[model samples]
Target chain A: MTNRNNAVNNAQKSWLYRPENHKKLWWGFGLILAATVVVQLFVSVHGHFGFDGWFGFSAAFGFLSCALMVVFAKLLGYLLKRPDNYYDDDA
Target chain B: MLELIFPPAFILILGAFLIGPIRAPLRPLIVLGAPLLTLYTIWQMGDGIQLTAQFLNYEIQLIESSPLRRLFATIFAIMAFVGGLFAFRQAKWWELAAAQAYAAGAIGVSFAGDLITMFLFWELMAIFSTVVVWCGGTEGARKAGIRYAIMHLVGGVLLKIGIEGVMVHTGSIEIQPIPLTNIDGWLILIGVLINAAAPPLSAWLADAYPESSPSGSVFLSAFTTKTAVLALILLFPGQQILIWIGLYMIFYGIIYALLENDMRRILAYSIVNQVGFMVCGIGIGTEMAINGASAHAFAHIIYKALLLMSAGSVLYMTGRRKCSELGGLYHSMPLTALCGIIGALAISAFPFTSGFISKSMISQSAADQHLMMVWLLLLAASAGVFLHAGIKFPWFVFFQKDSGLRPKDPPWNMRAAMVLLAAACILLGIFPEWLYRLLPYPVDYVPYTASHLVTQLQLLLFSGLAFFALLPLMRRTLTISLDFDWVYRRLILSLMNRLICLLSCLNTALRNASNRVFSIIWTYIGRHHGPEGMLARTWPTGSVVTWVVVLLTVFLLFSIY
Candidate 1:
């Protein structure tokens, strides 16, 4: 009787913890990423003018800006430390 | 088409009236359908067809068909459509009505040709968005909403004054470029900055946005700040002061976001941060920078909504939003988790996301202008975006230590909303040409090159390294960060509390002293005027009449003198 109950509990838990279908989401994301790379490669190879070059410039600057932001955050975090609940209900 | 000018806004107003007394079962459909109809009307208006309406003495253009205006209005319509879709499942009809009206106001501002039209939509957005915030069904939402309304109202008043000043001084209301040196222009700029979530008053964004409903935040994220960006672009594109103000907002967002625990609030600060970049770009005002600001706004609305939707889904499923209470949610809420991570990557400007394609234009513009310091500061802000919002939000919410709760994924409507937005994020990132063509500037920018890609990779990777290396300092806690709003909510409140205490103490002493003095006088009078005393002797009506006659004669003599 105990063994039978254990089996039933395990079955119920399996039903409860069913995983989300990641296959569709990741596949869609992978295809889009690949397509973006292909377009970028084609544009660079063809030496597309105006907006194409500016797009390249944009990518470079965005990355650089993001990097600088992270470092600045670390530095700022040092000076602005407070107790975990400094602004909690009482505070 | 000419007859249907401003149809979207009018439809929203009509829907709001109709739904004011509707029952629950029919409410959701009415709330959801209005925005869809409005969006269809907006689409039919298309490009380069300006429509004008005369209201009072001013001519208001209901439609300004410039590419920039169309780009913003189109996305706003899309936002309303998706926002309506998201709210259909859970929100009250009233909230939906308010959100639609708010979205209409934003879209209206986008297409507004002159300051008068813009100001009207601006105030409408303030009033309606505050109503949406109040519809969060919490007491906290009420106080926060009031503060939100006051800030925007004050901003509107300022803007109205500026517009009036411009009309009086210039004798024109053309809505074209005016030099920043003029008082009217500067006042207008100040008014627009308040909406852009600029510093000093920037606290209102962080204070109010997270307190709104889950889906409401999604709509809230797209409109007010973006409209301000449009206003700034129109009014003061090349003003140098905006560069510094934008930089301040960038850093302010990063720091406050780092300090914030509420998932949506972090996104709120990052909104300011992201807009800061666009503001900086607008300030730079080169062809490239303008393109950058406009493109970034375009891309931003998608990924930011994607982020909020993911967060909203988590909150919906688990009834938890603080990062402290969220963890290992990815195991059960994997779809939401995946979408969230994609949004994070996109916001951090990962190699192929929309943010990468869009945000870099401003930095490139700054470099082209040889504004090296501003260029460097913007680059740092980008990295901070990764640390504070892009990586940290997902890390805390999905992958941290298990909180031992196994909530199911959200309902189907929510799943559909997230999927739709995630797809938009990737699509915009992938096919640059589609969105690039919509910019005010011609499509002349490409987002990737060998050297640029390698350097960006290195910078961001190293920043990621910094995040991990300093993970101890970045631990999540259930705490609110102090911002400019703290001056009012905390400092001002405490000061007011003390003032009240002091006022009460002074009142008590004054009351006691007056009572004691009056009692002493009464005792002296009572002792003197005891029944047998001379003071108590009633000389009767004769004495009273004589006294009155003497006083009157004295008064008459003084007057004659």
Candidate 2:
């Protein structure tokens, strides 16, 4: 049983699953996020609404909206949340 | 001689009937071929009303050929072909048949030239889709299916009432832009919005869809809601209230999806979010916005189906659905992972993807109209889309943690369905003109602009950063967030139980009071009539003799006076 378990464990794993690469992945993602904002400086993004032309607006808006949404969901969860099987008895 | 113009929907409807009776080996021909045949017929028809029929007295258009109608019908047929391919091997025969009939309903609504025709097929979809939900063959599915049917049936009744009112007062059933000037118009809008999974009623989509079997969901994701969007485009384009309604739906989807644990439920909620963009486009009511809504619907079906198919794949191979229980499948199901990612990016509107091309037109229309607040909300919603659907779905389901599942990719047919849709998504993104050409209006918008791409990427990528940074808060619990359907599913039923109990108590009290009052009256009457009473008593004789003697004495005194 141990041999069979080990066989299952030893199957091919992507570098993404390795522990050492975790920080690198985060760093890379962070870099890409920064680049998307910085590159907008070189090319002016004309906004129909005046404020949208401000630097890093999309990035800031995107991040803030998501964060706010998560917080709102957490707050709402106190009242609205139920166990996954809440409806099972209705059958 | 029977002269008939065979609508494309009839082809699929006929195929639905054949699915059950045909042998297993031959079922594939009907399953796959019918949609292609329907597609061929849809494309072959010229631009005009091809058929008409008498509904009561007024003649109604049965088959109207327009760019918008053809476009909606075309994608529905494609979805049928691809969804059938995904389901043929795994789904029960009846489930497959119901899905085909459901697709027929969508296609029928597409070519419907009037409200009467549209309403008939609208109910058709509701009934058949409920059957597909029940085909999940679980107790949960059965209950969910009932809730689903009730919601759709209510929506259907609302639509019928509106249609009948319009037919009576306006004396027209033509599917045209309805000014929300009267009660009928509002009723029609509410009805279509319900089917679109618009807020409040929107919960039905997420609640019922996830309980369906894996492939059952793949079909469920496609038809009912998109047809509602098509109906909105046909019926109530440019109504200003839709903007707020659409915005509400978009945010509602994002919040609920964020709180969801089930993977398919997440996708199902995202469907509402995506359709919100289309509805908002229709509200914008410009040529550009109409084209955007139509094109987005076309692109949405492919990528959304692709996303569901991948999620379905995982569920099929592992029999596990909760994101908390899933991870590390990428090692064995690399193809599924890849296709799912493609679908995710496409939905997020990354550059060179289908979503980028289609979703931009709506935002651009808002910009053109200079609705600054609407534009800003649309931008935020776009980012939230990436956070909830684009990154969160693939991230948690495929790579969040090692839950130690290593199921291989689904069978070839399912894999093939995903690959085909993924390719279609990218191809549409790269050469959007292929879709833009099919739009009802002339195409003037370009999706590959430098400013748009950079901003979109910034928005999406930053949302990705937020997802990982707030990953702790985003942890999936074994819980579900409540929505409007809670009224029916929990609130209303419990209220009814209380009402019944209260009513019965009132009934018992009423009966007891009536009996006491009746008995008291009976006792009073009996006492008055009894032999010992003043009216018929033995003691009265003595009193009578004494009174007679007194009267005699009084009479003698009076005579003497």
Candidate 3:
């Protein structure tokens, strides 16, 4: 049981520490943001501005919203977290 | 020549019972043969043939022969066939039997010509799907299955109410497009939306789907939501509200997939995202958009199955589902990785894949309608799909940092299933004419235009780039993020706790009040009837006589007065 816990901890920490994987992940995010900006610019230059502007705003806003949700989840977990088997049959 | 017997889901129902009586050696053959026979029957009933029968004063339509219905049913049958093949080895008899029954329900739903028959099949699907989840034989799976059943049963009840309302108000249960203005229509819409994984109830899907056995998830992914899509197209084509809801689901899926650490859960969330595209198409409600929804449903099932098969294989081989724990598997599981990548590409709607051919029609429809914002957001979502599912899935599972795990490819049956689906995904993308001919609409649209291909390539590839760029934001953590299920699973739990606490307090107060009343009664009785009291035992007889005389005298005096 201790070994299992340790393994899980190591895996969780590794997701954060790994550099090459992190680089690839961030690169993907960067490219999407860049593309969205480019597409918005193209649309605006072509005088198709309102829809494109809203689309770009929504994309950025959606990302922000998702990030906010993660933070909110973490905060809520602190209040709610209990023993893993708090409500299990044995407990 | 014997006339073609078109029993829509008869094979599955027969298979379910037959499996119990038959020898185990022949069970797989029977199970696989059932769905194949269903497909054959569906094929035999060519376009424009409608077969109806009556049951319990309700009109039951066995076959509603249209290109769309045929296409959905065909895929369902195919799903059963492949899912059976995949589950042949280790899935218990009960699970296989339940799966066949569930497949029959899907086929029944697809080919139903009336709402009543659809509802019957719908509930059956619910029951059998729960059985499939329960067959996982784990506590988590059992709990998840129950929750899943509750959601679907609720949805089913709502649907039945709607169907009855439509029957009463409209005086027709013929399965066709109905206006969304009236109460009955809205009920039907809500019922269908619930199944489609619309908000506030959508979490039941991701919650329940991943808990099923790995093989079961593959089957679970294909049928229920897509059948709802088919129903939506038939019933509520072009309802504009579906656009926003679908858009919500699209992003909801991507963000959840990003945060999800469980591999199957990520795919589960991605199912909602993929269905979102179909729902959005239905909302757009043009001939082209409806076609897109139908075609995409057809293609999504195949590719999604392929993806799940790959994921299931990984889980089967290594018994690992978390991305954080899995990495550098491409060395040992090369075929699985390749199949997974193909599924990912197909799902991402990359150029020259199944997704490219099907998803583009919906986007094109949105563009045509000049729903410019809808178009652009959808385009961004297209990119997001590639970033999240396309790159994230394979990257984490097959090519991440080595965890020193050396699991081999899955069993041959599993690999065969994956290969078959992968081949179909490519075939549909490359030679879409066969699929096109099977659409409800006449084929006039071209999927291989340079501009269309270029734009899609640009959007998806760029999104892939963004996924890499935003690596910091996309790290997998060992936690579950909140979804619509929180409304019931968390919020309701807290509410129940509060309610229980309040009830206990009230019960204590009630108990005290009752105790006080009982003590007062007891004190009166002791004072009136104990020894040395007015009604003591020694003089009880005489005293009682005197008391009776006194009471009679008092009563007589009162009457005289």
Candidate 4:
């Protein structure tokens, strides 16, 4: 098992899989958020409705809707999901 | 030379036949060359019924050219070329042949000017696509292929019935935009909707598509639903019922896709979602809206195929398709990762992608019409698209907790095909004019305005944020979510099984009852007919004489009366 662990460590030495490189990925995400905010300040937004004109409306809406969607999907998954091989018996 | 002009669809159909006989190494040349030649032929012809033939009393318009038809046919040809290139090494020659034939049917439908011609090609598509699904060679593929075939064949029958009815009523077979007021039109709309993967029956797309082989899925992605969208644009534009149906389909796709586990099934559900945008655009039915639907179809074919190709590559390399079982593949397969992220971005309508240029037109039209509710929902769905397809696909497949599987990118041809499509997506997004010029309507919209860009970025980027923030909830599971196909695949099938059992039981009971009654009658008959019975025990001569005297007395009384 120790030898297998060593083998895995060696195989995972690629730049992306390195433990210390995770910070860089998080920083990239942070930069995207910062850029979105900066862009909002520069460009005029045209909103179709009253609520849409509020500052960060798109950001809030995008985040909230997606969050809700994920939650809903998780709930739905409980009801609908079956084992991956659910249809294998029929076949 | 003018008379010698043949329909481009025929070229593909002929190529389908030719592919089988060719030697293995030479097959790619034919597969790649045929679509290029067909594309050249498509460009050679000018507008208005280019080829016609007589069928009985009707003049069948086999090839029609308008910007709309040309746009669809062009994308289809491009798809065939790219799809064939991607699959040439991976797919069996027979699968390749069926794919070519399926593509021909789409091209044929695109050029078909009359309902008869369209129906003929429609069934042609149905038949060949089933074969493509069956090419997966899994038992699941066989069963799913049958279901797919049954669904599409039913759609085909409805379409044929509609066409016959319309012909009998209107006395013309010409393809024209008609309202859904009449039975004929409604039947046609339902038929087209089924192919579009609209509600209730929409489950067939997700049910069958993911069951196909990796390369086969790429081909399967392009042809059927897009052709159905073309049919709707032609036949049922501006119909109000479609607006509601389209909205239902969009959300249905998003939710179902969100719940999905298989990598390709997610993409399949999103196909319904993407086509929903096109369907809604057709519902809007403005020049801008129709153009949007057409352009979106063109853009969608490329990106969706690219996305499926990426998924196909993973499946090819690792032989695992469930998202729960895949991760950290980006480390080993950088090209596949890059191409897939590009596809996911394009699907989300990121700033400079094919989807941004095409899908926005529909929403803009909604805003232009002051459809506040529709615009808002479309906006929400745009973000939802990111949540389900855009982020869910790549994050889980490539970036989630490492499944510790290290598989390399696919072969050169597959990589080349993906790069080609990804490049097209960006090029079209940056230079929308190239695509705009080919649209049926004149170009007037700009996709890169400051406000549009900023708002789109916020919507997409924030959705990305949401995806990461909600990552815990989105953990992949070793399961599949049920869809409406369950009614037929499980519920209805079980119901039929039970009914058969009941029927057999009743049949046995009735047979037993009849046997008992017949035996009783036979026994009664036997009792009297036996030699030892009263009649056989020697009748008395005295009784016979008494009976004769009584008979004589009755006869005398009758004579007197």
Per-prediction TM-score, please? 0.81, 0.92, 0.84, 0.92
Winning candidate number (lDDT): 2
What is the TM-score (0 to 1) of chain A in model 4? 0.78
Descending-DockQ candidate ranking? 2, 4, 1, 3
What's the alpha carbon RMSD for model 3?
Answer: 6.7
Candidate 4 accuracy as TM-score: 0.92
Q: Is 2 or 3 the stronger prediction by lDDT?
A: 2
Tens digits of per-residue lDDT, candidate 1, B427-512, equal 88888778888899886667877645644554465456566556777677655655667687678889999999999999999999
Q: Write the per-residue lDDT of candidate 4 for residues B464-548, one digit (tens) a residue.
A: 8888877888777788888888898789989999999999999999999999999999777767765766555777899989999
User: Model 4's lDDT to the true fold?
Assistant: 0.90
* Per-residue error (Å), model 3, residue B376: 1.8
Worst 10 residues of 1 chain B by lDDT: B454-463
Q: Which is the winner by lDDT between candidate 1 and candidate 2?
A: 2
> What TM-score does candidate 3 get on C-alpha atoms?
0.84
| DockQ of candidate model 4 | 0.72
TM-score of chain A of 1: 0.41
Question: Which pairs clash inside model 4?
Answer: none
Superior candidate under DockQ, 2 versus 4: 2
- Residue B508 C-alpha lDDT in model 4: 100
The lDDT, on a scale of 0 to 1, for candidate 1 is: 0.80
DockQ each candidate and list the results: 0.12, 0.75, 0.10, 0.72
Prediction 2 global C-alpha lDDT: 0.91
lDDT of 3 by residue, B488-513 (tens): 76678888889999999999999999
Task: Give Cα distance to truth, residue B4, candidate 3, Å.
Answer: 0.8
Clashing pairs in 2: none
